[model samples]
Target: MAFGIFDFLSLIGALGLFIFGMKVMSDSIQKVAGNKLREILEAMTSNRLLGVLTGVLITTMVQSSSATTVMVVSFVNAGLLSLIQSIGVIMGANVGTTVTGWLISQLGLGKFSIASMCLPIIAIGFPMMFSSREKLKLWGEVLLGFAILFLGLNFMKEAVGGLQNEELLSFVKNVDYAGQPYIKQFFIVLLFVAIGTVLTIVVQSSSAAMALTLVMCNEGWISFPLAAAIILGENIGTTITANLAALIGNVHAKRAARAHFVFNVFGVLWMLAVFPFFVNLIAGASVDIFGADPMKTATGIPAALALFHTSFNILNLLILVGFVGFIAKVVIKMVPSRSEDDEVFSLDYIGSGMMETPELSILEARKEVVKFADIVRRAFKYVPRLVTEMDEKKLRYYTDQLEKYEDITDRMELEISSYLSKAAKGELSSNGGHQVRSMLNIANYLERIGDIYLEISRNLTMRKKKKAYFTQEMRDRVAEIAALVKKSLDLMVENLEAYERDIDFAKAEELENEIDETYKRLRKEYIKKVESGKFQVRSGVYYSDLISELERIGDHVLGVTESLKKDNELIVEE
Candidate 1:
């Protein structure tokens, strides 16, 4: 108990080792399980029941409920998973997290050396620490991680056990909250909450807090009632990571974080309300079930901790699931969906996106790319309206909006360009690396299309201001080119997300070729009219630019198709 400064540093060194091992282990485990994670979460809904289930399953796999919730938030932001479905995922994640407690309970926390001999666990693991291969180094870190996790726990137990010889025993034996009445215990709960929150934020791992809880309980330093309260507090505090991530995220993402905070807060409140009653109830159950005697010293602390985690999450889910829709509604109201009128484009996935994982990031970036492609579709959408309307004011308004759409494309190009740049800094698989390239290519062509739209909008605005008129033949020719380009842009955007799922792209290829031929034919017809002197050169100016703009947009479509073709070739190479 009279440890010196050197002893304290030794303990700090042990704790740091524990954290390093945990990180290595979590990373390796996730890489092993990564392929299956996405498939499981793909169709997760907004309802509470399914939400809870998704959360549980994901938490069980990742072994961290907080990680599961963060993934759900990222999914919701990407427009893959909606906010409503995300609520359920959050609830389920909380429930799923209890399995960790269950796992911890099942772990033979007191065992390990037999398997170590044949493996010479340290021999294999130590060299791996110095290995040149990155993957092996990661794997070695994982093995050494397991070694160090146990090593630190061993150190902690020995250190704490050493305290049993001194005045620390008398200090530990006292029911420190003895003088604390309801008001006192209430403040004590606040203290535990603060402890849990700070520990989780500092360590950035909920499991570490749980591990610390286990250590404290094992040391007989904290009563079961207080430990359980701290356990619940850990759940709430663990959410701070995601909440921080969501601060700069989209509305849906922010809602996902809000739901996490709400879920944890409700769970903690419910537990606090029934604290003493449940403490006695679980203690009584332990008495009969485990032959535990509360009259004497009981070491069923681990079981008690596990019970509190599971029952609390289950209870919280049962009560809060129904209100999930309302949670979504509240979040939506608080963080309204971005409208085109409000911003250049909806940045639903930028910072809040779960796209940090190479696989998921590629998917999210593709969605934004798809949205950008749709800008070209909107340009196409405007063509018919432009041709059908005769009012100068109406035409001008449409042109102005078209200019706005073009501006949106400019912003989107920059947004996605920046997003992909950040995304590329991580280690990318060959496919992911290529998708990054393809995405950059898409943005470039898209920006060009936007530029073309700007030119067309400027010409249209000029003609409207000049009060110039075009004959019916001229209008028909321009409309024909616009309609063709519109079709190509539609197919191009659709192919972006749909490329893999779409088996028969021959028709898409055929249509792309048709658009190519149509642009050439239109160009010929425009010049014919100009040569006949039937079309004024000044009138031909705007008409010629419109045709060129339409042609270039069509070319971008073909470029997209070619890129898809190239992506396939690369896939083949891989």
Candidate 2:
């Protein structure tokens, strides 16, 4: 019987089902553990060993190394994890992913089939999906995903079982390197590795690719050594997911993704050099455990492949963990930081994609909000420059910059708000919900502060156009109020950077009061000057408008602190 197009399509469909089920399980598990995962990440330290352990724990919990690496990239992008720390975690993730192969070998392809119980498991979980409790609902989804995954695995086994026909068996015999020369076998292994890499890249999920590889091996479609080679290729292919996720991320994120690629590729290269010895060792171990040679029969191939996958990653981790710092240096050199000018319009923390972990996404959005505050602070500096700059060219430059900054602020607010809204739609914890609200408020206030700067710039521009010059006294008074406003803006950024409890709300209030008092006194003095005709009305009007806009900025800065305080209180109450 020939393997027809329908058979190939069925195989593809089975793979898709497996990938979908894995995604469902991974996403549900992340939602269930989101807050705890955030706490774990926050509690992480500079200890590389601990970082590796954390990676293992998170990957085991989510059942997907791709998920773990993407989270790492997101965290690094948000400045939560350093490159060195992320590399260690990535190494651990490599080791952790082997658990899937073992699970498939023992449960899905073992003597008793878990797929036989898939329908019953779904029956048990289907009712709980209607549960009112969010946790229960998510748990139900996990159960359903678990059942569906094995069911798909069973389907793939049945589909691959069809390839035992004569035509395909002939092709397998041609490629089988069991009695071939050692040099020929090595080249064949390289060819299989390339195939594995392409397979993983196409699926975009190493776990799914591993499942397919295991099914193919269990059905006698490939030899143990070739399956092992494919596993190695999967390691390299897995890095592609993280790297693709980091395309829109910041420099640090790109570095973290590149580090994953470098680490996995390095491991694969060294393993290739020792490929023959390694497979022989695994075969020996399999014989001792199962009393069967995996090379001679397909019955023991699944377990032996599991052993190989686990051993390869563990040995790779042991061999390279010491050089994590070295790997980090390599990737940093590979993906160097861009200049500040190049990043002017970019979002440093939150990219276009949302994280699987909602709480983590909130953290990223929060970092982006802090970045928003800094941009406003820098733009405010341009405001003072526009006031004092006498050269036409310099003044034009500063004015153009302020206008550009104002547009940037608008975009930042829209993007941040859109991100937070999307995050809120996810399964967020109470604290995450509060954070989204607070970040929204902060972003709005920051944009308003930018607008006030632009307003002051426009007033100054009109002043220049009308030839209404400020007397030294008028300029100095405006300068004094601008200084007070600048101080308040700096305080706002500081509060944002600090922990919620550490925010100096008292200092913020003091600056706000001082600015209010300064505005009132300056207005009173300006009225007297206008009444006395000591200042021209045109100049006095522009000066008053400048000080008023400056005072408004102080108000918005205070608003930002207030929002932060409110968010902190809500979290405390929760």
Candidate 3:
């Protein structure tokens, strides 16, 4: 086993190219699908069946179950999807992940054929990736990534081809731990499981682990049986991703982590039961696939590997789809998250990876904005509480949190808009793509709404700091206007969600017109009364500023309402 410079350099180069290729492909796919991946994930309610289906569909499409599951954890943490719902998806993900194994098995990477022809695609793709238009660049990156990926596989396969000679082959083939018993094999598998688990956890990508498996398989360093056992271990090990992500999560969120683990462990258990039988089955079939000759190499069909990965996953998906509820219950029993538990979003919906998908990211961002708006509204609620000049400390705490949420709203606007721009650069349908753009606009307008309310809070603080108070008649008007302001903001928030399901432009217009008309008349009357010396200058100045701020709040409300129509056009120009 003398190492040569060529082999050493080739191996290092192949792994580097492999990792880079995967990244380019994943990023391109993400942008192309954008938040669409999140949308597919988000619709799974408490229904285990739908969750299972959603999980398989998403993982298969994204080509990375780990990414999908991580995203699930994020959604769970965000209060978007329930633990029960996520469990089914995790089960489906395990099945979907096997598709990779099948793909490698089918492709095989055996010889000189179409496997080598993809090189030009990489050549052309990288140049296109540097374009000014995001779409062209993303498309180029995806193609380039795919070409590099196949090239890496081809290089790895070719490097090992030299090892196929009799002496080198016999050395690797004669390998055996003669004294090792069943207990030792079990421990050996466990050790590999630990290694795979550690690597996946550290790298945060199961594809890396799987790629390692492919290399080992190619080298004949591990027989198909041993490699298959390790692959099985890898599947169970990947569940640690979502579980670790749920450490700071709520009951439902914890349950999702538990469910991901539970589902994976269940799959491993079943495979263990039928391990010998399945190995024999695959061995019998592998002969027909590569041909009956032991020395006969069919390295040309690289897709065979991919096919094997796909088949294993699809079979698992079919078998386990019905068992989702039982798995969900086990996770519930394992991690019973109560409603009273520190729920950040809903009981179990906020997964950390919620921000991963462009589409789902926006939804989670929107959910966050809604919560921020509530904080703003309650800050207004704090205004009424401000009457007795309550504890300064508590007031500061409340205002501080409200302001923090406002700050968060600002961050979300940037994130949502940027993610949307990336998403728009990808492949999308007319309506689906427009929705991505729409969500971005909503995030921006909602953020502006937060800014306006936060400004009001500042106004209140200024008034209190100045020890300003309204006159008797003005006090009544102030309270009335506060009521009006709160009402207007509430409507704006409510209508943000409403207009999506059903358009009510007329009603919104009417509210704006009424607020404007009332503000004009009130200002005119206040000015006349003040000029007549009916009120002190201090009161009049306070009134004027207060009325002006309130009127500006009304303007913001109108702006938000109006922005809905222009939602789709907002991001494209920028």
Best by TM-score: 2
Q: Distance (Å) between predicted and true CA of 213, model 3?
A: 1.2
- How many clashes in each structure? 9, 0, 56
Residue pairs in clash, model 2: none
Writing each residue's lDDT as its tens digit, candidate 3 over 162-249 gives 5554464474355443246756656655565566667666656677667766765656555554555566667667777777777765
Angstrom error of the Cα, residue 102, model 2: value is 0.8
Prediction 3 global C-alpha lDDT: 0.63
Q: Residue 178 error for model 1, in Å? A: 4.9
**Clash number for model 3?**
56
Question: Which lDDT values do the candidates have, in the order given?
Answer: 0.70, 0.87, 0.63
lDDT winner between candidates 2 and 3: 2
Off by over 4 Å in 2: 166-173, 341-551, 554-574
Instruction: Rank candidates, TM-score, best first.
Output: 2, 1, 3
Residue lDDT tens for model 1, 1-574? 6765666576666567666666666666566565677656764433456656767887776667767777777765554566767788878878877775654444523233222342366678889868787777767766766666656655655565555545544654465664578888777767776777777777777877777666667677777777777787788788898888787566668878887887788778877888878777877876776665332343567666777788878888898887877876776676676644322234555533345486787788888888778766766566556655788788877786677677667767876887788788888898888888888888888888877777777776677677666778878777776766776677777777685667335756777677668777877877887899878888787777777777777777777777776776787788
What TM-score would every model get versus the actual structure? 0.60, 0.68, 0.58
